[model samples]
Target: MRIDSHHHFIDYSEAEYPWIDDNHAAIRRSFFPEELKSVLDTHNMDGSVVVQARESLQETKWLIQLADQNDWIKGVVGWVDLCADDIEQQLQELVQLSPKFKGVRHVLQGESDDRFMLREDFRRGISKLAPLGLTYDILIFEKHLPYAIELVKQFPTTAFVIDHIAKPVIKEQSFAKWNEDIRKIAEYPNVCCKVSGMVTEAHWGQWKAADFAPYLEAVYAAFGADRLMFGSDWPVCTLSGTYSEVYQLVDTFIAQLPAEDQSKIMGETCVKFYGL
Candidate 1:
């Protein structure tokens, strides 16, 4: 199954997404399954995983409802307060909502504490996920990679996928520190990565496909096809470019790989990772 492994649907509001300041006015509105379905069809994507934008249980349930209504949404990576005392109960409630509820994501990048994932409460919550058969999505900036690396080490049996290549500083063409941590994290067999959110990290209006070459080269070498998957990171990515542009950036870059390897990054790896 050809799948867009990472993307989001939002009932956008400034109150819900405080990260959207004046610059993100482009996407200051709702985006639902109907809108995403058209783009998926155009790209020949057989299905997608609708990821959470807001860290709300209500939004997680809403996504589950969308998955119930839309067969094209093959899985969901919803938000849950992983630091909560009742995290296991929260996950249990979501899993009961639908078989499509596949994983959880905490916006670790936004947290001021550099070692937020190391907090006992958060790690305690992470422990509850794998027992219930849910994976964790690592959403962090390049600086948080060491914490993420430590995180995966503690839970070797639990599956984890790094979103947005950990949001590296591609626009500045900086890579040494980011590359080091990325390669280190990739050493863990249970961890995987998404080739998503690159455009937004580049020079928005003028970014060429070539701008991402170095980062791609680093990740492709470190993670290989088996550990990498494709993600559009749409709407937010639309702040810089179109979904088609994002798709083609990744699609064209991997064109030279052995077809089977290409297939794995494009979709198969995602299916197996989340059990979609």
Candidate 2:
């Protein structure tokens, strides 16, 4: 099946997306599965993995409900308080709700670099998830790459999907340290790269398909087709481009590769990584 491994949903009545607020007028409204399915239908995408945007159990439950209602939603990578004392209990509660709950994520991109990944409690919390057969979706900017590298190394048994390809800003075209860090993370067999969330990193309003090529090339080189996956980052992606536009970019970018490799990056790898 063709899977958009990374996509988002928003229910303004349910909870607040603090980062978005009124600042992101373009995507301030609700983005439901019905609308998303319309885009998927257009692109011939069979399904998607709805990822978490806020750190709320209620939101996680909401995603599960969405998944249960929509056959086209293949899986859900929701959120829970990784540092909470009852984290294991919380995950147990989540699992009872739906088999589609494939993994968990933290909005680590919003935290300060030094303490985000290496803290004692956080490490303890992450270590707990692996035993539960859960994958962790890592969301961070360039500065957090080292922590990501370290976290994946320390928990070699855990499955990790590095979100947004470490949020590379192709418009700025800044490579320096990010290039080295991504390569290091890719060295771990347990880690996978999700080609999502970059459109907003570019000039936002002026980004073109070509703008993301170098960053894309670097990630493809590091992870190869086997460990790479595609994600739409929908609703959030609207900040830079429409779902069709982002999907088309992925379609065009990998057009020349062997069809089998393209199949891996576009869907097969995600199915394996997220257990969808």
lDDT per residue (tens digit) for residues 110-145 in model 2:
876555778877888898878888899999888888
lDDT of each: 0.92, 0.88
Off by over 4 Å in 2: 13-15
Error of 1 at 273 (Å): 0.4
1-276 per-residue lDDT for model 1 (tens digits): 899999998888889988888989898888988998999999999999989999898999999999999998999999999888888888898898899999999899988898999999999999998898999999999989988999999999999999999999899988999999999999999999999999999998799988899999999999999999999998889999999999999989899889998899999999999999
Candidate 1 residue pairs in clash (backbone atoms < 3 Å): none
